[model samples]
Target chain A: MNDTRLIRVVDDDPELRRSLGWMLGGAGLAAELYTSAEQFLERDDLHRSGCVLVDVRMPHMDGLELQRRIRRRGSQLPVVVMSGHADVPTAVHAMEEGALSFLEKPFTKDELLGVLGRALQRADELVQREAAHRADLARIADLTPRELEVMRLVVGGELTKRIAQQLGISERTVDKHRERILAKTGAESWAGLTLLAARLELVSGQPVEALATA
Target chain B: MSTGRDQRQTEPGSVERTPAFPSDAFDHLVSQIDDVFWLYDCQRERVDYVSPAYDRVWGRSAARLLADPLDGLNNAVVAEHREEVRRAFLAGLESGRFEAKYRIRLPDGSERWIHDRGFPIRDPQGRVVHFAGVARDFTERKLTQDRLRESEAFLRATLDALPAHIAIVDPQGVILAVNRSWRQFAECNGLAAPDHAVGLNYLKVCDDAVGPDAAVAREVARGMRGVLDGSQSELMVSYPCDSPDERRWFELRVARFETNRCPLLVAIHLDVTARRRAEEQAVRQQAELAHVARVATIGEMAAGIAHELNQPLSAIANYAEGCLDRVGDDRRPRSDLVDALVHIRNLAQSSGAIIRRLRSAARKSEPRRSSICLNAAVRETVELVRYELETDGVVLEMQLADHLPVVQGDAVQIQQVLLNLLLNAQSAVRHREQPRLTIATRSGKNDVRVSVVDNGPGFGAVAPDRMFESFYSSKPDGLGLGLAISRSIVEAHGGSIWAERVDGCSFFHFTVPYSRPDIASGPPPGVSETGRRLGPAQHKEATA
Candidate 1:
């Protein structure tokens, strides 16, 4: 685990927070502790590459609420929910709210480290995906309006002839447009370009079909 | 008067001659009198002269009595008295004196009681010359005497039939009279007197009382003195007077009264053993029910309690794990590991305390009364339910008053009451968007008051006071014994419990009296040391 990748422990219990900090530090991961979800939410570095471990039962803002707020803020800081007992309903709720893992308290040091590792891995993946989507948006922004239309059709699995007919252009012109779309998006093949477009659709909040129509 | 005496001294044959001294005046006086004045000739065995009053008494003419001296005795006297009258008449002639009481049969068949007496009239030589007798009618006096005797007998019977040991005392504390029950009790207790110690100074007896009843007896004596001296109108005190064969209780009541302008005291000792037993039984049953309720409450909150206990255990695990992780790293400061170990120890101790509290609450033990700080008790009880409230997202605010006087009560029972109220509030606010509960303690004039206010739908159409009724439940799954048991426990602790709705909040309030400093060092008066020690044991036996 990268020492720079912080493990944020948010709980109402000060002792638990302190002990968790010590445990994470001993495991070669840097840790930051907050006594409550509200205190955790006050961090300006939520966009940093890290995961937050929050207690599900807190005073003001619970772990699930914090998770929702993080999502709303567009920060993919993976949330790891901790519950004092085997509270299945709350665990399920936290998981549904995009928690990376649900850890019941009195968890072993290995369990804590394992869950934190997974949460950090998830955070890294989300950051990479966000960067890739930003790169994709920029690459897509570079294309001409006509080439962009052809790229959408090609990614939609339309044949080159059908794409040329839909856009009222020649088959040769549609093929040329697809080649440039692939080169600008840095794709090695047509399938690769389609895969990139699918990933873009997932992160960009737009459906592939909608982007194809556009 | 001289002419009437001269006529009596004259010979029987010379009685018809008028005396020179004022014969008309004497005759007029004799005719006006109500007594039947008659002169009998003892030697001749005949009646010489009979006054006009004889006609009225015998219901015959005076001349007829002269013709037959024995006419009145034979005809006027009832058959039951005829022989006795004849014997008295003859004895009077022989002995020169006569006295007899007999009933006379009137012409209308009504019998009148008569007291007759005769005195001998002798000459100067001291020889008996004639028997002068006055047969005066005293029937009214005799009838009045009979009625008075009958009424007195009825009053005595009524007083004797009462169950209370009753004695009437004078204003000076002297026992004037005692009834049959009092006498019987005295006899059974081997009191020294045939009249059940009547005329004895009651105050002295109370003052001289020994053994376990001395204090109560002294108190009774003081109270009786208060009543008798008009400082108090009445006195009532209940004391235990257990016999060798059975436990007993008696209520002594002394009331002052006036009859015939003389003040008196009626001290009555009523047997109240059955009432005390019933009260003790109720208290025992309440304690038993409270124990059951406490167990049931713990059962209901098992999940929450487990979670509450789990918090500390979880913290301890985390701290221990952290310390272990640091123990291997040389770069980690020793102080950090030491701190983590300390946290682990503290957490372990806290969890143990929680378990201890839970065990004590769940265990069936005798209810013990002691002076307890209300704030401390409230905090301890709040610790048990804090997790449940927090888990349910209910906000709890405690406003405990500072320097609250200690209340006398059973800590477990009081805690049960607090727990019941808290749980009820928690359940009431379970469905609310933002549930809030506030528990506040305040010192009142004579008690410490605790109030639990909840911001849920206030006690809707049901009267607030009815909430304490047993089996009166608004919840579908409720047994409805929590508040009832709480009320009983509070009342047994010399407190009161009530509920009210104010300003859109449901408030449950209970007050436990402040422990009296004087009584704090000893058991309450009127209870013997053995009885005090045996109270819970007796209750347990009875329950078993």
Candidate 2:
């Protein structure tokens, strides 16, 4: 799994880039090298499941800037910022910008490997979560509009009669829609259906209240 | 005997009688005159006649003088004047004229200066028979003449004592008198006139001057004429007059004065070469101090420099580590291991180069002149400050022109100038939202200009030229010597430096000539044609 995962190394120094590639390759991992952050950002597969190791001080776009750009593009790829010196403020800034880790230069082979391993592991977990969320989103997409309304109200902790009244429908019809939601989402029970609805709300990036109002 | 002589002298138609008046009448006139009339009988060796005024003039009785004429004359003569008197008497007797001015002591211990004149009376056979003359007291007139001569000697001595070459000129600019110093200077400079060019028209000389000093001489002439014509009371001019072996400066001062209502000019030329040299030395010492201060400022950038050094070192370590890892694995290709090793070597070399550049800059040495490429210098200097700018999030842009010509200057000093400008720009934009600094180079007609521009609060209240003044600081802790030193360094290399505000940016621009106008063509001493130190191989090649 680690070998399949790509570790993108972005730095302005050519020797550092080449050495990083070799080191990662020797450690039984796949590595890609880029001379600058801009070059890395130009890739169409930026949203792919992988981790990026970027120097904190690159020409034009820095490591923190690259992290922000990735996040803005809705990519959950983990970033590890490398600094030539042990600058606390820059490290803190990188962390605040959602970097997975900060590495000072002259780091030992073990240190680099350790940081990259953790970043890749985090990248894997993020990829898995994204997949699960997409699966939930697709599953939630299948239900009828009435079924979704009933599910949102159910997840909102509203009783069946209140939900039926809010929807201007009979309680028996609301019960029938809930049953369909559970069937479509593959939930074995009412609790399972509610959990599925929560997952859908988390993935769809919409608050449960908004969904209920809708 | 005296009665008989008087009776003969008074006889009508006497041989010694006056043609128009009687002998007795001349005797009466001589007795009444204040001068003493006497007659000396050379043949008889005796005094023949003496007027009554002799008693009052010589303070001796006539009878006493007649008794011993030699005793009377010798006794009254002062000891110092006796020999001169005697010598004059004997020589005059032989030469048929006796004239002596000598001091005589009276019997009362008073002194008198006497003027005596005598004529030879010849007999019919042309043999001298007697001598007659008048003696007068003229002591007061002699004293006045003596004082006047003493005063003239004192004035001449004073003029010669002064070191400044001085000359007194008339209203028409004719040099009347020149002091000893002036004469000596004229002689040294090969002026042929023995009187130190006196009687020469000074204004014409100035107007006719040739060579490099001609213009300055003409200016001096104008100033002097102003003083002479009463347009100005005095005029002073300082100018360079270099000799073949050494450089020199002189100051000329001209003032008008009157002596006996005659207008005159006193022109003084003072050698101020020492003062000029001292001033130049002070400026040079300040430059040296500024250099030392610049090295100290570099110390303040230690963190950034270390960061720059760390990059290559870290790369070396990474390469070495990778090479070691691969060497232990039998499956690793030999070519791959060799590649890593080569990279490690190259990284180490680059790190060494960085340290070398730093040491070269920090070392305190005499500034060297050479042809240096501005682009290369800019690139090298940027290496030292890149880390700091990056850490501060400053946006640095370099727009160096392609094929920019090399300039003549000290590489380290030029770098220092660029470093100062860069650091100042960085500090100016440190607090801004987007700190942007741009360093650009351009080639002009005869020089290359470099500019460091910063997007920050422009020089609001401070004048652009005032910013380059020494000790003029806007920062709280700044010594304010950076731009000042930069200006001096650039100027010393025959260039110019200035600062200005344009479009909300503080721009510092300096230019260095492609070849220094003062320096001759070819490489400076101790440097090769390639702008490198003359090593043994290069020296041999150069000689060959």
Q: What share of the true interface contacts does candidate 1 keep?
A: 0.53
- Pairs that clash in candidate 1: none
For every candidate in turn, the CA RMSD to the true structure comes to 7.8, 12.7
lDDT of 1 by residue, B130-213 (tens): 666677778889888888998889988998999888889887777788888877776675563545677677776676655555
For residues A1-214, what per-residue lDDT tens digits would candidate 1 score against the true structure? 4456888888887777887787676667888888877777786488678899888888778889988988998787888999887889998888888888999977888898898888888878887888876776766767776776677677777899888788898999877888787777677887877777676663344544445434
Off by over 4 Å in 2: A130-214, B1-79, B84-292, B329-335, B364-383, B386-415, B429-457, B469-471, B476-481, B484-544
Full-model lDDT, candidate 2: 0.77
| DockQ of all models, two decimals each | 0.40, 0.38
Docking outcome class, model 1 = acceptable
Under CAPRI classification, how is model 2 graded? acceptable
What local distance difference test score does each model get?
A: 0.77, 0.77
